[model samples]
Target chain A: MEKILLKNLGRPGFHTIDSCLVNGGYNGLTEAFKHAPESIIQMVKDSGLRGRGGAGFPTGLKWSFIPKDPTIQKYLCCNADEGEPGTFKDRGIMENDPHLLIEGMIIASYAIGASVSYIYIRGEFVFGTRRLEAAIKEAYEKGFLGKNILGSGFSHDMYIHRGFGAYICGEETALLESIEGYRGQPRKKPPFPALSGLYGKPTVINNVETLACVPAIIEKGPKWFSSIGPEKSPGPKIFCVSGHVKKPGLYELPLGTTMRDLIFDHCGGMLNEGRGLKAVIPGGVSAPMLNAHELDTPLDFDSLAAKGSMLGSGAVVVMDESTCMVKTALIINRFFSHESCGKCTPCRDGTPWLTNILKRIEYGNGRPGDVELLESLCTNIFGRTFCPLGDGAVMALRGALKNFRDEFQHHIDHKRCMVS
Target chain B: MFSDKAKEEIQQVLKKYPNRRSGVMDVLRIAQRERGGHLVKEDMEEIARILGMQTVEVNASAAFYTMYNVEKPVGKYHIQVCRNISCLLLGAENLIKHMERELNIRVGETTPDKKFTLSTVECLGSCGTAPMMQINDDYYENLTAEKIDKILKDLK
Candidate 1:
């Protein structure tokens, strides 16, 4: 019910630095500067805030991953490369409330003892990138970002690095590579960004929405923050509910808000002459599809996982009866095939193979054993690939097959998509 | 090859970078803007020659991004409809049908009049404002057939 993350959106001149200042925007960073970095980290940890980025990684735990030594020059990276198929919550926050992201970045930088921060935005987000860069310039001019903020002994510099339009760059390591002015590709983990990232030093990468929520967490205190949602996944979250819904837009609510509220109450139900809800992809295309029966399931990381899906990026994609699952799978598979970084074998080979197979099925040219081949190929690529991208591709294929096997059968047997 | 005026603008962009190769993306962007949408193969070769980099490097960069249309000629107004999961559910299929019928061209094809080119993009990061389409650089959100018709008429 509380509008913390989206507090300034839709308000007059909310994009301006003056309007942001009037609403106590940079006050959190000033408050944070007064405290020790470890104390700020402790406060964040106590707040029970998790990453609003699909991963739902614990924000405090991720910050704690950074080394405490002052000699080491740690980096704070903001994952504004929102390439998830259905997610746009970050863009809204970045465009309308750019200063909030700046303030959050400053607080996060202070918490982790980071001197420099980078907001790596997607290349296609031309307007959002310009707005964010302008906001950063404004922040620097106002002395909220430059050296020794508010007469305190903390100094920070922020940069906006625009991506060259690669979905793989949404991955933290790939984002680091892109920020370093290279072709975006995912790096092997275990060295994880926190331990050895961005010039092989300790770095912290937080999502745009995750960082945007920090100022409110800092201002409202941890107890108030923890009480908003389910105990494990507490705090407010912004769900970008779209597709088929009458009032399709972003809705800010507690983490455990049900699918019913999102689809029916918030989004004003499906369009197209009161069409029945066919299916729902709870968290972008990467997350598995849930039928209308699963609408009662709570929207949370664990809850969605228990139902064989993920709370990925909070991009709730609704489907109506007119959608053909086979065609949908083919379309989604094409994205994976194109976006795969080709770091490993399974994803590099498997995605294209699956995409080709799905394409054949969608086009009414599928062979008899194509379904089995698709499943086997997906199984091989699911966990074997280097990054979660392969897993996403595999999950998308398998989820489509599982929920709509009859459609795949229809494509093969009938030699045409059943739903046109 | 780029014209003298275009070349001068590109040189200013190149100055921002330490190495010429670093300016490859910016040069390609400027060149595309100069020539309208889509870069020709010759453009890539010329850019590589201008930047003192290998042609493959420029080609590779051009190939990686979806924004750069390397092969085809683009229409004056490029309309990219978001047909990913979100937009798909929000009558993107119907919208696509309407676009094809109105423009008399299929996806990835330009209208005969060279006025409009329609293509489907994955996501424009405007899912919050779903059923959206991008014309050139500006976004038109919460799209309906009537709205799209009005937009096309305005473009015409």
Candidate 2:
């Protein structure tokens, strides 16, 4: 499949507006301006593009939810807070070929009738931030932004809002709060961001990769895009491969590519020839992991869902047999414990407790019934938190227990890691 | 008190948003940078005055985010190694140990000369190049012991 998202990547000066225009960037916004905004939304809906930011929400459907009244101020936020443990694809887009994202954002803002947009980038991504800031400046200077963009009488202002090292800000609502100069904590849903967002006005939030697809969808028509991948989830997906893979990097393939091909063929198998695959976290740490037996699963929204995992952010973390499952669980839980926004009691309190128990087990001080105790704790915390952070921690621990229950048992009973 | 340059920068950041409160993070970031990598109580108070926000609100926003060092100052080089699962699987812990041994300071501790502070952070989105660390604002990826030694030695 042809690479739509990363097509301009690796070209010298691809991040510059001059190079981007030479490579046919901003053509989507020009094409979008020729049609009614509603038609562009419809085109996106027909293209079957889903939000690449974990939840897999449809992009056009999300845009359509905005109140059609043009008088009300609407905002579009590009979520660049790419802090998920094993996910790094968005960073690649923002740091390299930033004009692609800028063009996509312009097209999206135009489609949604948003005159203002913000790229809420993570503060740690200083380099990506500089690239995006420079690109936005270039776009404004080139008459692609500001008043009467491309003589279409549609004006949009884009700004870069740097997130101050809070992972919770990746959540759309929390991102809105952060932009409002408050603590980055999630707000209650039912009035989603599409309705009451970014200062209680209608807003649309999209991941960096999801918005980057808009230019291609408009320039090449919807059918050409929807026909590339599987019928349900059609598009070029960037899968970030890391961990014990021999060649770890970003691989852009059609959605629904099988995990076996991604790990063995694309990533060059395990870290070395002697090492065997133990398990893989098919998404970020938030998604349920898949054991080596489940390597045949196709990596997509629906397929991974059917297998009780998720294609979250398309981050595939490969682990070899030398990895101890118990230690893995402990490390993952510790991350959740540290990152859990203290808004939810169950998440803020329960994550540390989960980390504590996992640490005890990994350190060989675990007693009998600790494994069952963990199972009970997961049951209590799974559906009881304010947001998905608690559920993610529980799901990750449950996935580990489901596949490596005996390993946990051995750690408690034998006082050492089973593999190591 | 903020420097004239920082105040000018804060005003520039304020112009980007409709609400004055929306500029709090940028103001705090500027204050932290001006104060040499950490925010002081007086700095937060001054920011609240300038932005028409409560000092408690400024402090809360500063404390909520990890990048702002509200409590203690850091060294010239803040060496934060990624310890998330992907990096962990690639011997990030060994890298942390190596740094500790070389610096003669444990994790979260500044060196005796206050030149280097070693800390373990969660993923910085460089997972494809495992065992990575960020020094100040730069990323050093695909690390080895020799690479780390050179990186540390070359830093002024």
Candidate 3:
């Protein structure tokens, strides 16, 4: 598919304001001012846009949830804390065409009646932060931001807020807590961010990729967007394909693209000869791994969910036949264990237990009932935790066991890795 | 004492947020960078006084984040290797092991002279270029054993 979101990427001087303007940049902000904020929301709704961050909630529905009251302070937080293993698309947008995100934020904050917007970015994105800061300054100087923006009587202030390396902050509620100068922990979800968020005010939080898509959806009519992909899942999507692939990088495919095409056609296939594809983590570590045969499945939110997986952050990590499943499970669990935040007991306690058990199995210390113990632990951790972190950690455990039981069994029975 | 430049930067960060506390992470980073690459207890006190926060809160905030160094001063070269899923799948383990052997130090140990400190971090978001490591602010990716040799030799 022709790239709309990443078209400005790698273009010389794209990060600068003049370069972006010359390439028909802030025109989306201009296009947005032509309609009422309600009409803008309605257009996004009509576009059938879904949140690109792990959750596939409808973008328009999420924005519409903001309180209609004009008295409360409303906010738009851009979740750029892209530390999810195997996900790297957001880094590209922030690094190359930062003004695109800045422009998207202006249009989105205006639609949601927010006077302020914050880009909650990952601390590891040092280069991204510098470029985005420059973009914000440029946007401010051009009158695209600040009071009476573009003379539309809609004022929006944009700022870059850096996160100090925590994965849980990627979750919206935890992100709000981090923004409020507290530890990054998930809050009880009775009052969602749309109602009371970011210092107890109405807030609309969105992923960097999701917000970056808004300007284009407004520029092109909604009818043009919904016609691009599957009716239920429309619009272009950026898949961050990594791991053992011939050409592992970001592939911008229209929605409903098959996982097989992404790996074989788009990414150029497995790493090398005699290395057949083993298992693939369809999304970030949070999503279950798909087997070789399951590669034919369509890569969309509904399609993957039907197959007991999710199009989470569209992070497709491919592994070759030589890769060790047991070791992969161990490493993924360790990531969750290190970043659990310890807010709630289920996640705080369960994550380490999962990692310890996986470590023992990988190192050939599996006991007789270890498999059953893993199953039981995953069952307890899957849905009982406060946030999805608990469930996400177990996704690797569950998927590895379900698809590659033989490899795990080999380690348990022979007390050695089988892949080599 | 915070440098004049760091204090000015802290003030600018404070002005960016409606709430003063929201700039805690940035202030901590600046303070850590300015004060010989780590936040001492005294530095935390200065941070608390500047942000109008409790010293304990500032210390707690520093401890909560993985990037901030409060316990000990980091070496001039802090080698952070990414052992996350993507890099792990692509020889990141062997690369990490290679570095361990080459440097004659373990993952969590700093050299006696404090020139280099080695640690394994979660992910640096450079999955496309796997087997990557971050030394200070720069990322060295698509690394080979040969690449490691050259990088270490140059740094040495």
Best by TM-score: 2
What's the DockQ of model 1?
0.48
Residue-by-residue lDDT tens digits, candidate 1, A1-420: 769778877775789898888878887877787678898888889988889888888899999989988999899999999998988899889888999999999999999988888888887788898899799889989999889887888898887666766899899998877665456778878889898998788999999999988887787777888888899999888988777778777889999999998888887788776568888889888998898899999999889999999899898888788889998898788888888987789999999999899989888899999999998898888889888999999887788888889999999999987886
**What interface RMSD does every candidate have?**
2.4, 0.6, 0.8
lDDT tens readout by residue for model 3, A1-420: 668778866576677889788888888889999999999999999999999998989999999999888888999999999988999999989988898888889999989999999999999888899989888888889999899988899988888889988999999999988887878888999799899998889999999999988888888878888888888989999899899999988888898999899988988888987789988898889999999989889999899999998999999999988999999999999999999999888789988998898899899998767888888998888889899989899887899999988888888889999988
TM-score of chain B of 2: 0.97
Model 3 spans > 4 angstroms off? none
Q: How far off is residue A138 in model 3, in Å?
A: 0.8
Model 2 misplaced regions, further than 4 Å: none
Q: How many angstroms is residue A167 displaced in model 2 relative to the true structure, after the best TM-score fit?
A: 0.8
Clashes of 3: 0
For model 1, what is the error of residue B86's alpha carbon versus the real structure, in angstroms, after optimal superposition? Answer: 2.1
Per-model TM-score (chain A alone): 0.98, 0.99, 0.99
Q: Which stretches of candidate 1 lie over 4 Å from their true place?
A: A272-274, A416-420, B1-31, B38-59, B70-73, B110-115
RMSD of 2: 0.9
Cα-based lDDT at residue A407, candidate 2: 97
For each candidate, give its TM-score against the true structure: 0.91, 0.99, 0.98
- Native contacts retained per candidate? 0.60, 0.92, 0.74
